[model samples]
Target chain A: MENVVELTNVTKTFKDFSIKNMDLQVKQGFVTGFIGANGAGKSTTIKMIMNLLRPDAGEVKLFGLDYKTHEKAMKERIGFVYDGNVFFDGLNLKDIKRIVAPAYKQWDDTLFYRYVEQFELPLTKAMKTFSKGMQMKASLAIALSHHAELIIMDEPTAGLDPIFRRELLDLLQELMMDGDRTIFFSTHITTDLDRIADYIAFIQSGELVFNQSIHEVAENYALVKGGLELLDRDTEKAFIHIHRAPTGFEALADNMKAVKSIFGDTVVIERASLEDIMYYMKGGVPHV
Target chain B: MKIIISNSSKEPIYEQITSQIKSAILAGELQEGTAIPSMRKLAKDLKISVITTKRAYEELEKAGFIYSIVGKGSFIAEQNLEVIKEKKLKVIEEQLGAVVTNSREIGLSLNELQQLLKIIYEGEG
Candidate 1:
């Protein structure tokens, strides 16, 4: 498996916040979901990948090529969608295409028109007049028209309704049939990832926490519930975070095997969803 | 071939897929050398991530229930039916032995156990 996007020890600093020593890899030919809370440096990391913001320290490469020498070549193969509309507000879809289409050598007018018809987007209406979902569809139509091998999206599902969100996931799955395309999208909506994401890259407060396959996550992390009597200095080592209630105690365990061995059948271990992992992680990563 | 997935089931999606396909092979529904849908195609049709279908197919291959070529898709593997049947029968015998011990401990007669087994077998059909 090749890595389409790679960041090695990347450091970017701002006046108020900084992403420190972040090492991330987006594997080729799969959907890798970028997940974190708002203001968790997801957008900052994406900007670095897009070469809009340069990392202060480390290397950022796309398709094994550095942006310094291959900016034009790399961006040509990468399609991007930002959280907010990056298009001109006054321009209609046709005018937007006219300005954007000339930049890509592989842009296909027929494919663009086909996506326009399939999405039922109004080509004549101003982009500002279109609804949120329509704007997303318009952006997607353009991103997909150029035969891009890598698609990087930041919060692509932020303000859409549930029905359209599902439709968007289905469309992404359809695009993945090609077997050459790679999708890396950041979203707070974990349900969307559950449906289609192969790998999950979870960031926390400007730090890269873990990048693992969804199956690896399922096998490792779990929510364990048991009596408070199970909590001791020795036994508490199994949990990343513990929440106690009058009835019982619920804790997030990073190692399911260790939890099972330490507690045996005394505790009930359940699969932890992505949201649950994120929520429990707010308590802070445990010291090794 | 049709595959029905239950999201609410405790079993993981890939295990569900592997077990269903395994049963299909054992029941002779999918014959030897029958071409199966590609993992990506199956993933798209089932509305699941491609990795899940890939894992299921990999498991099937590991268990000798299927095989795949580099460019070609997966196919049902040549099965040694006698060996598989014997393996399954051995498992059944072990389960039945446990059931007999439990029934005897509860003072149930062999005739009562036979009648119960007949009822369950017919009802399942």
Candidate 2:
């Protein structure tokens, strides 16, 4: 299978938190959601993929084209939407489009007009006068109108109402129906990914925790609930993360058969959700 | 679906899903060709794990209550009406037995328990 985006042993560091030894791939024609907690380095990894930040080690490739070797050509075909406003506040919707459209070789004015009308964005209003949701819609309209084959969205739906959130997801779904376009969606909202993402890649503190098909991720891990005795130091060590409750406890284990064997009758293994997996990866911390 | 499950009920989550789905099929609430929620969606709705929902689905398939066509999805299995009726009655009786056992522990006569059940069923409890 062709990979639209590939990261091998990618690493990035900050003064407080650093993501190390990471690797991931976003396959062609699929929506691969990059999931993580607030400080799990999701944005950091996305930056590396977009080549905004140089990785301390490893390489990122787009359509088998190396980022360093084909930076200009690669970027033209890629639409990047940062988590916040990347356009100037003083720039009106039309002004922003005017500036961005000329940068892409395949920019389509008809497509741009279609998106603007569909999103119901105010073309004459400055970006600062638009609501956050409207600004995001404008950003997306600009991104999608360029005929870009690959789109990298960073928390594009973070502050949108549920209605608009669904709208954006629907747009992406429509885009991917072509079977040639790919979307790299980075968000803390797992529920957004739950609907349309074909694959999910989880990043943690800069490290690539796991990357796999959504079906595989949903099927592999289970929540084992039992008495505290089930989490004997040795057995607890066998699981990824453990959460203690007053009556009993819950833990995520990849190998259910092994966990069952170790704590037969004492532990009941239930299925784990992607949200649960995210929570577990965050050291059982509650989702804020 | 003619199904019963309780978060506080002693029955497991998988049993709740399977038994309800089975009852729905047998009671004609869910038709033979009716599509069921995928394991993942069911889990999300119930806020449980996919594993538990999958187990319920697997058990349903094992009991010949449903079958899944890969990539196409899962549906209720077609069965003879008589066989479906029998399975439904058997499960109903099993539940009635458990209710009777608990009713007896409360020092209620069969007549009184039946009255109480009537009230409960009528939403007068």
Candidate 3:
């Protein structure tokens, strides 16, 4: 498969948190969602990929070439939308576009205005006065206006209401229709990923947990539940993480087949969601 | 053909799509050679993940229920009696397997389970 973003053994460190040797690949023609709890290295990793923060070691590549070699051209191919505005708060949509659009090689004014109309953004209002949802929409308008091959967004829908969130997800789906644009969607909202993500890469406490296709994640893991009697040490060992209650015990097993073989149909096995897997893998609740 | 997806339901979204399409084919609601929406189009309409729809289309193609032409949309495949029969049997086996599990969990014997199924089937008729 063609990869649009590749990070090989990338490492970044801060005073209190650090990303260990992390290897990531965002393939072409898909939406790859990066998710983690707050304070995880998601932002650090994204910054490294964008060259906003240089990695302490290893390389970051875009379009299969080192990001630094042809930074100007490579930057042109990527459209970015991050939390808060990347523009001056005093600038209206039109003024902001005038400043930002000149940098992209294929920026189209007609397309930009079209998105402005579609998103119902106020063309003359200062960005700072816009609602959070409108600001995000305005940012997305900018991102989608240019003919970008890859669009990277960091929590684009994090604080928006459900209506706008759905609209944003719908837009992302429409964008994928072209079949050539690759999207890097980073968010803490795992539920949003359930509907649109092709591949999901998760980070926890600066550690890479898993990066796999949605099908693999959903199919390969299962929620195993049965009477509390089944909570013997050996059975617990078979689970990725286990939760117990007085009436029953439940566990998330990474290897569904292994769990089935161990417990058989005596215990109920349920399809696990992305959120369920994430929470359980993080050693989620085990309340009794 | 109609496909209903529920976030709260236990069935995976992709499986719901495939099963619905498969049933449509078996019931002849979708005639052979009928063109179907592209995977992206279906996903957009369903407001679901593109990958989920893609997986559904892939499984349908793999099962010989649909075929795609380059650049053109996928269409329902010509029915092969043997293939359709085999596929339907597999669906039945899956349903029966679930029945077995439920019955066993409830401590119902095989004979009792069969009797209950007969009563339900006859009552429906």
Candidate 4:
């Protein structure tokens, strides 16, 4: 698979925080979910991808083209939705369309209207009057109308209701039928990724922890529960982090196979959900 | 073909898909050369990531349960039903051999074992 977006050895610095040596790739024709806790630099990485913030060091490439030379060509193929409404609050949907539609050469009015009707977005209503879900739908309708090859969304589902979130996922699934469109979206809502994301790019404190397929994530990470006797220094090497209670100890193991081999039947190993991984990883990955 | 996915299942979604499709093929519900839904379409219908369905199809192809033509989608493979059935029967026989050994170790007679098997098999129905 071709990488639609690539960042190699990227470094971005802020006064309080900095993203160091981040390497990430968004594969074409698949949904890549970008996940991190608040202030985890997900938005900063996304900004670099969108060319909103240039990385202080390293290369950022889209469709194998560098932003330095191919900025226009690259942006032409991408439809983006930011976490907050980028549209004018006073402007109505029709007016917003008029402003945004001209930016894309391939913008199709028919397709745009089709999405408008499908999403039931009111064209005459002011952006501020629309609910959060409606605003997301409006944004999505615009993002999808331009026949973009890559769709980038930053926290598109952040404030959306469950029903609308599911609708958005279904819509994305339908769009993926084209077999060429790539989607990279950042979200703290891990449940949304379970249905649509093929790859998960997890970031922590501005560092890329892992970019792995959903299957790889499932196979590699697990939650293990066992008696405190299993917590000796030698045996503890199998776990990424361990939580100890009087009754037992629960731990997150990055290597499921190692955990299984080490503890055998003495411990119970269960599948770790994305949320579990994120929660445990917040303690920070120990350099074992 | 209808496939039901249980999010809570210990079995992975791809395994569920493969097992269901395999059963359909073995049960003759899916005939040889019958075209199956494309992986993308299946993923859409199942409300799952395309990678999951892709993995399922790849496993199906590898197991000789199906074959894919470039751009033409996948079709049920030509099945040797007799051979498949014979192979399965051999597995059952091996398992039954173990059961017999365990039963004898427990001082269970052949007649008692036959009665137990009959009851268990009929109970499933």
Error of 3 at B93 (Å): 12
Q: Write the per-residue lDDT of candidate 2 for residues A7-122, one digit (tens) a residue.
A: 88877778998878777888886678888888788888788878889988888888889876898899998988887888999989888888888888999999999988998888
TM-score to native of every candidate shown: 0.96, 0.69, 0.88, 0.97
lDDT of each: 0.95, 0.79, 0.87, 0.94
For model 4, residues A1-288, the per-residue Cα lDDT tens digits are 499998999999999999999999999889999999999999999999999999999999999999889899999999999888889999999999999999989999999999999999999999999988988888899999999999999999999889889999999999989789999999999999999999999999888899999999999999999999878989988888889999999999889999888889999999999999999999876775
Angstrom error of the Cα, residue B114, model 3: value is 9.3
DockQ of each: 0.81, 0.06, 0.59, 0.85
Q: Which stretch of 10 consecutive residues in model 1 chain B shows the poorest summed lDDT?
A: B21-30
Model 2 score (lDDT): 0.79
Candidate 4: tens digits of C-alpha lDDT, residues B3-108 = 9999989999999999999999899999999999999999999999999999999999999999999999999999999999999999999999999999999999
Instruction: Say which prediction, candidate 1 or candidate 3, comes out ahead on DockQ.
Output: 1
Q: Write the per-residue lDDT of candidate 2 for residues B1-125, one digit (tens) a residue.
A: 33344756557667888877866776678888888876655654554444456678999999898999986779988868796678778999999999999988988799998888888989953
Q: Calculate the i-RMS of every candidate, to one decimal place.
A: 0.5, 8.7, 1.1, 0.5
Task: Write out the backbone clash pairs for model 1.
Answer: none
The segments of candidate 2 whose C-alpha lies over 4 angstroms from its true place after superposition are A284-288, B1-125
* Tens digit per residue, CA lDDT, model 3, A254-288: 87888888889889998887778778867532333
Candidate 4 regions exceeding 4 Å error are: B109-125
Superior candidate under lDDT, 1 versus 2: 1
lDDT of 1: 0.95
Docking class of 3: medium
